[model samples]
Target chain A: MWYIAAMALSIGFGLSLAALAGAFGQSRAVSSALEGMARQPEAAGQIQTAMIIGLAFIESLVIYVLVIAFLLNGKIPAVDTIAAVMEKAH
Target chain B: MSLELPGWLAVAEEVFIGYFGPSYHESEAVFHAALVIPLLLLFVFLSTRRLEKIPTGLQNFAELLVELLSKFCTSLIGPHGLAFLPLIGALFLYIFTMNMFGLIPGFKSPTSNVNVTCSLALVTFVATHYYGFRYQGMGYLKHFAGEPLWLAPLMFPIHIVGELARPLSLTLRLYGNIMGEDTAIAVFIGMGIGAGYLPFQFPMMALAVFTSFVQAMIFALLSSIYISGATTVHEHHAAHGEEHGHGAHGAAQAPAHA
Candidate 1:
């Protein structure tokens, strides 16, 4: 029971932190790219491509955390198992 | 997790199991991947059947796709990149089509599966190293040796690890994104069913369309960047530094008007 709770908590906390970091990193990248584009309108195309790639890289890091959360989620007991445990305890 | 739509292939699997006494099972991802190949082949064949100086209909669309892909290849990997048009173009089409397949009510994205994405990433991995060796010969090994020569010991292992991580990261990135998107849509759809089929997943489906295109382009772009990095000669790197730049910065700046 404790194990399951810990896993769930870790997954939630880990994902939240990852999402927070990813949002900050992506926003920074987009803002910098937008500034660059504004400064040199002719180079907007290049800036946009760079920004997208940077976003992907940052997004991938968050996805890594997501994958880990998924793996942890799998370790949690299924509903049927949990129900069986409760019945046995009672 | 419990509520999910059945893809066409899943329905077929059910029929097959009924006939074959539960002994036969086929993966939906495999079926979808197979379906995509024949569809792409047919499209290409039809589009190229009657080429003209002044294109029309499917021919025009085909030319546009080819032109865009060609420009993408050349812009990233230089003039010689045209040689890889077939590989990169096929990958772009295959991945894009598979990604879009999930949006269809009776279809699922093959790329949402790790096996499919792993195989695709492995192809890029193999091709990158192959082109590296073919173009740079034994000097390709020097890539791991790092610059300044004395840092070989520290850099060699790091480079090898980085090289290995590329395909792993590629596999996970594509698989995770598509799978997450598909799962989100499925969950929303399940919720909608409880809510009297309210089309709750509509927004997600719309977002999937944009993400599908962006993911496909990113995969192709990253593949081209890897290939160009591997194929570029050591001296050429310095020579083209001003014109082409290097790494992501160079690739970003390559096609100013693109």
Candidate 2:
């Protein structure tokens, strides 16, 4: 029970953190692109492209953390089944 | 609280119904693979076989997809990206097709199964490094080793962990969105269990459809990004920094103005 509870809390916290980081990264990307456009609208195309690439890299990092939370939360396969089978054999 | 099938997959399945059967629910992966593979191949054949000097009908649609994906990939990976197009395009199409399968009446999405997504992600994960090595050669293995010997111990595990996490993240993200969307749709549709019209069902159904489209697009976009990152040389960053001057724009820029 405690294990599940701990997993749940961690997942909640990790997802929230991922959401926050994604929002910040996305906004920063948009803002930077806008600034570049304001300064040199002709470069908007290039700037926007770079911003998106950078934003994706940032988002991937957050997704990485989300993956960890997922594994911890038992969304990935758990060892319990294998352990139980072994215990039965013993 | 309630769920309904996405319209696109529903329409697709309606077009080719008995290609899938009621009893054959468990082997969703094979069913989806069979259903989508032909349609996708047909699309490719139709799109390419014409050799059109001027685009029309299927040719136009093919060109449009090509243009969109090429531009998107090139934007992220830079020029000389044409080489990676076939793999990236196939990945995106396969994922989106499998995801949309969930909305079909008798067909569950293969992607809704972790086993399926994991396999797909593993392929992408392997492909990413394969491309990385193809471009950079055995020297690409250096990325796993820290430049400074001192940081090697700390950085090596982090690098390994990060790479391992990529496939897991990709699989989970795709699985979660599709499964959640399908579950929501099912619940909404099931509300009609009691009532005839199923009051308040229409809006939920519409939202579920929208979610499906968004999730499909997100998966395609992210996969493209990963592929692009894998294929590109990191030298561009140094060149870009020199050109853009991230240092020049300093803290003098007002926070609110930003």
Point to the candidate with the largest TM-score.
1
Candidate 2 collision pairs: B2-B188, B3-B184, B3-B185, B3-B187, B3-B188, B3-B189, B4-B185
lDDT minimum window of 10 residues, candidate 2 chain A: A69-78
TM, chain A, every candidate: 0.91, 0.72
What is the TM-score of each predicted model, taking all chains together?
A: 0.91, 0.65
Let me know the TM-score candidate 2 reaches against the reference structure: 0.65
Which DockQ values do the candidates obtain, in the order shown?
A: 0.49, 0.09
Kindly give the stretch of ten consecutive residues in candidate 1 chain A with the minimal lDDT sum. A45-54
* Residue B174 error, candidate 2, Å: 0.5
State each model's TM-score restricted to chain B: 0.89, 0.76
Error of 1 at A64 (Å): 1.1
- Candidate 2 segments exceeding 4 Å error: A1-90, B1-24, B199-213, B234-258
